[model samples]
Target: MGKMKRILYFRHDKIGDFVLAWPALAMLKRALPEASIEVFVTPVVASLAEACPYVDHIILDTGDDKAIRAQIAERNYDGIVMARSQVRTMFLVRGLGVPYVVAPKLHWYQYCYKHRVNIQMGEGEPVWRKGCRLTERLLRDNDIPIPSLPTQYWDLSAERPKWQAFYQKQADSQLVFVHAGTGGSSGSLPTSHFVSLIRQIHEQTEQPCQFVLTYSGEERKLAEEIHQALADTPVNVALAPPLDKLVDFAKSLVAADMFIAGSTGPLHLAGLHDVPTVGFYAARRSAVHVKWQTLSQAHKRLSFTPPPGRRDGRNMALVDVDLAASKVAAFLNQDQGK
Candidate 1:
């Protein structure tokens, strides 16, 4: 690691997990301003990765180990961090020319790393904080000063104002978003739950507001069902405009007065702009309620997690919809609506 000029941070994983690592990437780039920082990611999050201003290059993990290793070797990275550990990544980095390797000290196949960090999985600290701690450890051990995390890393300067302008025309019409998809992860409520929640928000909100419902390809029917149920309501329920790219949706979040979703990627995207967020996390997922908190202003975010040890707590259907809606409406009332 002598005079390190280049480094690689590997996080070829889920969308939410990858989005959370944005701050860690920012810390690394800020501390090592002169160094070339590269990231390894899967195609699903490639658009967001490319949107990141911290990293200089993006390495697509196309499941081709041989070609990936070749690319890694040529880059001559001084070190690599296994932010998201996998069996494929374990073998890929083993015996590679990279001088140092770092990874969370959890998995059975974790001994390969020279710098192993014990990231307490169930601890209440955010996953992104653990990821940043990994960067801090690597930098501090090598006597590098870790800079404080940035206010935000995803640059929405071009996209945010466009959406913001649209919301401004309606005389402080609060733009609230509800994303019903889990992105294939667990502990998500059904569309029926979202429909009920949306209705409550509409009837309960103190001011006039526009609501947007977001879903993926698989949840179209559910979105339709929710829309159909709310069609006759006083509040308008509109489907999120279809976007050509994931980055576009991420950018659009900056315009939101409030965003609601499960502990999923889109919720974290709302965090990028410090948008007020309401997240539904299930206890079965350890609802490390604090662990999965959105990256928004502390007072602005709210979370609902099923309590442990209770039979109903683990059931997504048993979540308290009324409580969530009441709190949401109360928050909506605080908005400076004309």
Candidate 2:
């Protein structure tokens, strides 16, 4: 029952995985303000951990077993939480012999956790909430009071002004940011669909609306194709800055008033910033609204999927661009209170 000094947490996954773990990490911070919570994350999402205020420290997972063991032994953490469980991580924790370990019981290495919570991954509960449950189970087992759920988490106050100043030129116009690439996680809309969506947003709006297309370096071709398709339209089209650095790319999302993306990391970033967003998704249960839904407020966000029977694979691409555009128009107008 003594005050725990240091706690180790694991979420060494992709950008989207870490994004979904944000609220749970924030909950841990709030409930045990005195504990030094350090998260082990992959290099791909280290920037996000650096940006997150939830954890006191971030340990990069370099994939070297010896190095990882040395780091863990030196820290002498009091407790550990495996939010995103992996066999390697379980083996590492077991070898280090951390006194208190917690993880979801759904994994193959459930016995490795000293404290395990039954967690199910499906439409029944969000992935983020599942993380929170693991944390809650750990706290309850130790007689600690659980904190309220976190709806969103982002430290953008410092960066928002910079974005505002940079986008002041188009201050009069509604900024509609769109990401045409899906990072190959789920289904993506056709390049022509994005082009049509951008044009439709422009045509449906009364005032000027500027559109920015954001993409990864590998997705430059897709961005260029969307840009080329918009050539005949009056709508202003600009490519988002290089996203080589995660923090810089995160800052860029703050300047946008509205964002359109598939089930991806950027959509979660927009949700964190409370930017009005519209997300496209496949009809599959895993990809539907119940599982990959955004944390953004209902009034500020929209989720679109194909009809019940057609919701599968590339079926999301069949989501009528004109219909999706109409929904986007309505959502933006509501934000304007028009």
Candidate 3:
């Protein structure tokens, strides 16, 4: 009931997880309009939090518990909301001496097992809103009003100049963006698969459409391969740099006709921007890990798992890239006709 002057929001996940939590942050801002909302994120994803509209400060993960404790103690935060239930975070909050602390109730062992069982759990919410129930519950317990899911908006004027240039190059044709990497080290489609999918689309469409391939950090190799594969073809493929300037990457995705990608942040980005997306879900995780705005009826989400008899020791599974491509092409064709 009292005014919350300063609050800490701890989400030490990857890029996609942070993006998925944007709606929650937006809701929290609305609920506590006067509070200074700071986010604690890993170093790799700290930049994203800095670019979020609702976050006022960012604490980078340095893997130094003492330093983290010192930082939190010095800040004198009014409350701490641990969006992630990691043991490190729990220990950190306990040492901060905050008046209010909120976290998920699962035991450390169960939490670890859940993450091991499915990497998607490491991301955040699951499909049908089952995984994120804990997030909602945490907010409610802290008297934070739940923000509406599937938030949507568009701002063409705010787009980066490069995106505008890319748009102009296509002339009057529809543009489809294809992203093939996820936030994790693996779990992305192989270059050969991506090439096959793009080639199929190009042949079917008679080279009328443009394909933009995006990658981040080490995944640039995959983007390069896509470009090489489409070199002789009419499809245009290029690597998109991490748009550090944009407040929300989700906003950029709104300008696209359709988004096709492996399970990754861009897929979720498309969802937040309300772009129709077709995602290739790997067998290592459930489809629930894929975060999309609930309002997006245009999305086609698929998960590929090997047959029980073909199960290998490795958790990875091969997705049907051709099927995913067909769905993407069909979705785009429908949108264009409309």
Candidate number achieving the greatest TM-score relative to the actual structure: 2
Q: Write the per-residue lDDT of candidate 1 for residues 124-237, one digit (tens) a residue.
A: 667788788788888987788889876656656667668866544255467888888764444778778888888888888777768887777777677778788888878776
Q: Write the per-residue lDDT of candidate 2 for residues 60-164, one digit (tens) a residue.
A: 989897788788888998788888787888777776757778888865678766688877775556667788888887788777898886555774767766875
Candidates sorted on lDDT, descending: 1, 2, 3
Clashing pairs in 1: none
Better of 2 and 3 by lDDT: 2
Relative to the true structure, how large is the alpha-carbon lDDT of every model?
Answer: 0.80, 0.78, 0.61
Q: Which portions of model 1 show Cα errors greater than 4 Å?
A: 155-158, 165-169, 183-186
- Would you give me the overall lDDT of model 3? 0.61
Residue 97 error, candidate 2, Å: 3.9
What TM-score quantifies how close candidate 1 is to the native fold? 0.92
What local lDDT score does residue 43 receive in model 2, on the 0 to 100 scale?
A: 95
Error (Å) of candidate 1 at residue 258 is 1.1
Which 10-residue window in model 1 sums to the lowest lDDT? Answer: 164-173
